[model samples]
Target: MPPEPVAGPAADIDSLFQRGYDRLYADDSTGAVRAFAAAVCLEPGHGEAWAALAEANGGGAAAVQAYAHAVVVDPGGWMWRVGLAEALRLAGSLNDAIAAYRELSGERADSAIVRLGHARALSVAGRPAEALAEYREAVALRPDDAEAALELAEALTGSGDALAAVELLQPLSRRAPDDAGLHHAVGRAWIALREPEKALTALRRARDLDAEDRLGAAPLIAALEAGEGADLSAAYVRALFDRYADRFDQDLLGKLGYAAPELLRAAVDRVIGPATGLRVFDLGCGTGLAGIGFRPLAGFLAGVDLSPRMVEKARERALYDDLRVGDVVAALEEVPESWNLLVAADVLVYLGDLAPVFAASAKALVPGGRFAATVERSAEEGFTLGPTRRYAHAEAYVRATAEAAGLTIRLMEHCTPRREKGVGVPGLLFVAERPADRPQIA
Candidate 1:
């Protein structure tokens, strides 16, 4: 039940389409659709009216059909096809968008914007390698475009071409020398390349850029200063909690099934045996995930993280009696035996070696206080620091390190706490007690 195309004067049809296009431009969708429909009625073969109607309808199947009709009437209309591709993308019809973009490639062979859109659409369609090439092509065409360069870098990173991404982003970093996010991207890319020195330099730049912002460049700045041989960057550790600070509960709890905080709380309860009025510190509190679990048990709760973002998020929850933004170990060092319990959940994974943090925690703890932590489990020999630079420690390694730092491993449990890349990597949930007297064990 569709109206047939009416063939009329070209000027009349063009005027009708113009009216509809005007309505669309004014954000009057209902009036635009009516005007476009009327224009199509005036001249059934008018490509512009049909294309206008298609776009006005938000690129649904009916809209697509209208665009097809327009293309059939005027096959040389490249702009109409480009609009059709955008409409298709909006409709989530990626395959149709790809087809339209491919058709566009024939008409406008070297349009950078066209290529960039096509690349983004292709990436959304899960063709990352092809998308990467398209992004690279777009960047080559528009060398001065920061967005093109960033997209190319993102595509390369998504495709596991990190070294190539580094090569691209490093130069872009210079161009956008004051963009903290850009420096963060460059630093991450350098880390992927296993170039820590380069990573350090870039991350420091990020911190300096971030310093202008109120949250400050604490993450990048501290990491640059403290992250060195056998220690994780302060910024990197800060970033973990900061990135997840906002939507940690909904994302990690809902999607990833993260339960480390609660599990650690239960482990602490079992070991400590219902101790009352204990002063607790949640190191790397990270949006108060650990605080929520430990709050009931503690006489008072203090939270600390390197990221001010995470600190702000934690503050919103009002779980911590007090929250501080600083490096975990440094914060712990200043506490002066104020805490009877210190809980670090999945925080050590960001640290390659635990001796310094452990020593700091031991120093922070009151006599006979306990340190509860969750660590990523690796093989007996221990896992090497990967491109992410997060270390997965072996059971023996943790035990040895704990004992070396004058802490006694009271309990160790092997549990499948979380799934990574669909592989169930073992996790170590342990309660290590700092002795009343400093006792060094081998």
Candidate 2:
């Protein structure tokens, strides 16, 4: 997928190396690996062959070893170093990726592409501020480059400076009038600036240009909805969580002041007392924030999430006894009546209809077991999907839903689940208990 490791023509190259190149372009990764392995065997000094071998092997442990060998054989090959850095980044070795990226910067600080790559690595490592600095440098190096401008605009947006991002992207939009992605970026920045009309205009233009472009379609649909929708698409939610898995905690907790997990744990404690040795299940657990907080109260803990990457991230924390990668409802069905304490803090935002989740939570809980969670509160009856792509539920609707689902409300209180743009997001914290006399779920 990365361009050939070597510079210039491969016309004079050995037969094995040429055979490997043919196999690689043909998409036969295994054959390419074997051919490249043969080429490197014949010429142990061929750094390019080793690098090619690494790529053909899909950049696993073997790839890392081969890339390391390539770098050693050709210490001056910046391309090989870049390959290794990219491999490390894909493998979730963020620190190693950053170190390798720094090595590239040391070789050529003015290389805009290398600087951009380093900035991206830093972003993935949850160092957005540092990534912003690198992006600034990259933009300064190549002001007219569309790629660098896009990166800088995205970084500025993430840093809560949509006006700055708009300024950066406006000129690019004019320069590349036909670029659908550029328009999409500008529309998102406008939306952040509270200019919904402008965002709609730009997004509509983007969709007109490229109907199938992913960024334009999802946001365009959300923008078109304005303040009403049943719920967001499952595919979109999965993609969003997967992409944010790396920086979910840093952005939500440190940047946005998200305290739902702590609040939910406290509420649970008040309802069941502290350290009750409950069997806990965390629905839509992203990185196990709530699970970690509830660990002391649990005799056994398990987690479930729609995004596999988010599940993997939670697994890395090693707090849960088990973790499932699929829909929350499907996960609940797997262990009916197994949990004494089920937590879904900040996860209800994705479901505009609370009936399904409420019913599932009721079925999954043992007699007298508690369901504690947070939800963005709606001013009107029932629920509505907000412009932020999260659903907000009304207090009356929640109470009625819990009653119908066979759960008794133990506690309901107002709280700020998190902040957006330094403003608190209004929400509700609730604890409901399955009736002790209710029949067990089949």
Candidate 3:
């Protein structure tokens, strides 16, 4: 009798799935993608594996395909459907995402999350009228939902009705005075109405309610005094980003829809001409979002950040010729002033004072070297710490600061850096050059 064929050990699917998630949670997308692909191959109907695979891919064609399969394998699963819809949304398939959400609503019409998503999809798709209606409906269903009110109020404001945004929240305020977003919205609306006193009052309440200061304590101070500003310390920012590194790209690119990096790259090409063979320095280069955006233009790319975790993520991209975790100001101080371009996409928002960064930046660049950055636009005459614990700078302040630092503005224009509360956050992107003839400052 022929020797019995050796039996192969069974596939340890649970172990494989767990390992896939471990890699994903640690931000090892490539490893996680491989593990998840193996899990799915072992069991095609593994809805969770499919979903994990979708997340690993970060919402592209691969994610769309994975999520679609997940929903197919588990038609009755809520997360599967939600994941598919969200994946579709982030993939820029607005119509398909909306249709999927609508179909889900037909089956489970009471899901606030689904309706909220539907409203957002509609808003981004430029069907604001329909979006407004759905937002109103979502708010009605969950009157105390801060996120719902935020989106609804933002939508109202976008429609040129700040008063309505205020009015919509006024009743909610009495019902939930402890709601941070409620008071924050009221403060924003009051400012729009030009009622300084009322704005200060509501902003104070918002700060008090936000014990963790997620709404930021700096903005509260700004309302009380012209020069009052908030500083989001390096430690706070580093800690915040360390925890965020794993999902940074997804949250910023897919959901919040950050595009400042691309905007800065465009300004570089338009203002500096060909960027090829130029030395590029990326300040606060979190996850290399800005690094990859400008890599094609660089002969050499280098980056620095306060968050080591962010630096690590940036390193994985292989876009930078050098990446270091250090104080941005100090790093710039150490580097020789030979860079052709420096860009900080959404980095200065954590800093209340622009003078020092600008001064350091001015000294770090070669003659005619460019510094490109973005800041939240302030309506007043100076910089301010805002409700989001991020700093905003006035155009006047930015221009004066640039001149004082020996840099001349090449371009300064209004741009949408990202979406906050489902609305475009107003910002300014500028490319300023070190005067070729200016003597180096001691």
Candidate 4:
């Protein structure tokens, strides 16, 4: 036989599909999309072609539709399902993505990577318990998987099962002794378990390993050293806000059930007695959580956050007249004697020492202007840093600081702002006024 006849259209389509995959691997999404489309035209039944097109769709609705079609065409392909789940996750349909992962797991329950993906999806979807179970399954399948163990530990800690998380990571911690994240996880576990001394030791090691990456542990160490069990440093507070800045409203307010901003607003209404056309600056306003509460009371509203991402998100709400990215202390100093209302909700808990902040806020306010703030309750500790390294001043200390800064206390009361250790922590709300002739605090 001089020349052998080529196979059917399906074979031709397979060749074209190879070309498309090569294009995909070479980072030419558009070319790959075109090639894949051509392959699908050549064989009409090429499931991989549909999947390739879907992957190349780059967040387009048409791309998702193509992926859906690919899944329908080849419902048995684990690859297709994985691609679809990943695309959905990127599109921010976390719950839908999670459902896809679950479906994939049902089909291939023994796939360690799939199980790991499932766990990640669950964690992002805020189903930490389910995620933890999936992570455990993944670990059981492959015990030496460092990523699986570390991620599992994170989900466990985030879900408030720190002790269990520690157990999961204890062996890995011994092997990967120098991993900063591992040590940090151990420290967090100790902290959650209410063993401050142990937490201090582990967290200190974490910091020593990589100071930049392990920034949160410093505050926690300070808290332990200071003999305060329930205090955190400003750095820790900032880290908390930074990590949750994008999802603060949903995770903190929606999931964890917080209402600090609203509680502050109610307290302010009672003390200030409803005034119209008031200018309000929500200092430390991460993602405008407090701005929502200020909407009714404030005629002019502005917000500031240290994280630019938070400031951008706050701007998206159209609730702020201006949003600035800078340190709150600097922002306060820049706006000397301007705003009538300065509300710092859950802000002062970060400051181990309030003298500087008090002075800055005093300078920022107009004469007779009110500064309303919230602070987490702490037993008298004479200004020592706690394990969390955030300063929690006693009620008397806070009052003394405000008074020393030329702000006379107007209203002081206690309320529960948010939960700590599965229970609400007592917080104080104070509204103080800077007098006309502010006495200098030496």
Off by over 4 Å in 1: 1-232, 387-389, 438-442
Cα lDDT of model 2 by residue, 1-442, tens digit: 2233333234334777788889999999877887787767667788998898898888667787888889999998888888888788777788998998897899789988778878988998899999999999899899988888888888977766666788888888988889888898898777665456667777877878886776645665574566522235454566568778999989998989999999998888788775757899999999999988988888899898987789999999999998888888878877678889899989999887888888888899989888999999999889977888788899999999988888999999999999988999999999999989986433
lDDT string for model 1 (1-442, tens) is: 0133334444466676677778889999777787777777777777877888887887667777788788888888877777778778767899989887877876777998788888988999999878888898899889878778877876766655566677777777787777677777777666654456777787777777776644344554455456543445463454445555677678766666677888898898888888767899998887788888888888999988876887898899888888998878898889666779999987777777788788887878887899998888887575456545667889998898888888899899986666666566578899998888775332
Candidate 3 off by > 4 Å: 1-230
Between prediction 2 and prediction 3, the one with superior TM-score is 2
Considering summed lDDT, which 10 consecutive residues are worst modelled in model 2?
Answer: 1-10
lDDT of 1 at 23: 81
Query: In model 3, what lDDT does residue 300 have?
Result: 93
How many Å off is the CA of 68 in candidate 4?
A: 51
| Reference-based TM-score, model 3 | 0.50
Residue 382 displacement (Å), model 2:
1.4
What tens-digit string does per-residue lDDT give for candidate 4 at 190-305? 77655677788788889899768534878778887887654443333434455566677777775556778888888788887978778899998888889988877778898987
Task: Give the Cα error of residue 137 in candidate 2, in Å.
Answer: 28
351: Cα error in model 3, Å: 0.8
Global CA lDDT computed for model 1: 0.76
How well does each candidate superpose onto the true structure, as a TM-score?
Answer: 0.52, 0.52, 0.50, 0.50
Please estimate how well model 4 matches the true structure, expressed as its whole-model Cα lDDT.
0.77
Query: Whole-model Cα lDDT per candidate?
Result: 0.76, 0.83, 0.83, 0.77
Worst 10 residues of 3 by lDDT: 1-10
Model 4: CA > 4 A from native: 1-236, 381-391, 437-442
TM-score of 2: 0.52
